[model samples]
Target: MIYEMTIQFRVSDISKGQHWYETLLNKKPDFIPHDGFAEWELLPGCWLQIAEGIPSIGSGPLRLGIDNLEIERDRLINDLKIEPFDIYSREEVPVKWATFSDPWGNKVGLFEYHNQSEKEDRKKTIVGKQQ
Candidate 1:
């Protein structure tokens, strides 16, 4: 059984990729074992790895859960100079989401749950209760 998981994204330049990820995630990488490689533990067991290499074409639109979609979208556009993207939602779906690309064309997305309580519960499950 898999106890932990990691998702990797390749970029042409490690420095720019690291900086972009730092801005997007709002923190420095938790580990950097060597040059051209970096990682962030997105949750208790989920890791995001960024490396220096040719970026995979049409790789991913890796979605991350957030507390607010609009706030995050605005912040990214303003800080990272990302192109404004649309947030989409369905009547049957419980979350709103938007997708954007990094400079190297890695697709990244953000999503926000409509039910705040559910969001908090998921947060607790991932990181334990907040005091």
Candidate 2:
């Protein structure tokens, strides 16, 4: 059966990539096994690896769930100097989201659930797993 998972993003400079990700995630990496790589355990079993290499063209908008998308969007803009981007949602969709690129062109985004109960349930699930 399938188990834990990892997702990787490439960058031209490992140190810069690590710093950028640290700022975006608001924490240091969980692992730095070697000189050119870093990894963050985003959730209990989900890992995001950033390595030194050519960034993948049109690779991903690796979206992360947030409690407040507008707050995060503002933080990214003020702290990271990310250009402003539009947030979008649909009539039936339960979450609103926005996408922005990192300095190295890695597509990243934030999302927030419309239903407060659903968001609370997700937080409890993740916190329980981490403990």
Candidate 3:
């Protein structure tokens, strides 16, 4: 028996979906099937796939994990043009994670280590959100 972990996103438009995902993943897809789909091999088994449809608001019992969240957060903001739907953080937590909504409403997360400077920055944001 064999198992394939493919996460499918129903996109509103395949072209826009492809561009949005390309920006996030930093490359074009490894494959395109027919006129309605693309395959982005994000990890060894996990794939980011988009096909023609209305797109899901979100249906998550799923997430892509990383060793550190803050580093990626910085890159996403500075290098990859990520604007988050929501940002979350805490001073004491060693992980700094954020969420981004793709063009067709798929969710993407970026993360980095909560080093002292990052912790201070996030602490302010978290504290500000509380007020």
Candidate 4:
């Protein structure tokens, strides 16, 4: 049983990133240390933090999903000046989705859950009909 986890973000400007996160999460950051560290307690003990740390390529991947894909995508572009790419598709899995990188080049995703239950959902068959 898991309670919470932090989504760590590395940024060129930690303060600016923290400000952008405040807007995105619609809440003031829980804390901002003078020394290039800021944290927003997203849920209970969980947090999303930005720090002025060096970024490196990593094997572990992180992703986040949103119900409103377009709105989230636009906000990143308009406010944070981050670029994104659409990799996997909605029709491919009955849900619209895309990937975005954070200011520190961490991969993130945007998703719209048009279908939640997998059992009732239909898949395309060889005959081009619902399976």
lDDT of 1 by residue, 1-131 (tens): 98998999999999999999999999999999999999999988899999999999667888999888999999999999999999999989989999999998889999999999989998898788985
TM-score of each: 0.96, 0.93, 0.64, 0.64
**Top candidate by lDDT:** 1
User: Candidate 2 has what TM-score?
Assistant: 0.93
Worst 10 residues of 2 by lDDT: 122-131
- Pairs of residues at least 3 apart in sequence or in different chains that clash in candidate 4: 90-95
Q: Which stretches of model 1 miss by more than 4 angstroms?
A: none
Task: Please give the CA lDDT of all the candidate structures.
Answer: 0.93, 0.89, 0.68, 0.64
Order of candidate numbers by lDDT, starting with the best? 1, 2, 3, 4
What is candidate 3's lDDT per residue for 41-69, written digit by digit as tens? 77556677888888778644235444456
lDDT of 4 by residue, 21-92 (tens): 676666787887678888887545667777777755341245544557787778778877776555466455
Give the Å error, residue 126, model 4.
37
**Pairs clashing within candidate 3:** 69-111, 69-112, 70-111, 70-112, 70-113, 71-112
**Stretches of model 3 off by over 4 angstroms after superposition:** 1-3, 61-87, 90-94, 113-131
Q: What TM-score would you give candidate 4 relative to the actual structure? A: 0.64
Could you tell me the lDDT of residue 49 within candidate 4? Answer: 74
Q: Is candidate 2 or candidate 4 better by lDDT?
A: 2
Question: Model 1: which ten-residue window has the lowest total lDDT?
Answer: 122-131
Q: Give the per-residue lDDT digits (tens) of candidate 2, residues 40-82.
A: 9998798999999999865687999998999999988988888
Task: Record all residue pairs in model 1 with backbone atoms less than 3 Å apart, i.e. clashing.
Answer: none
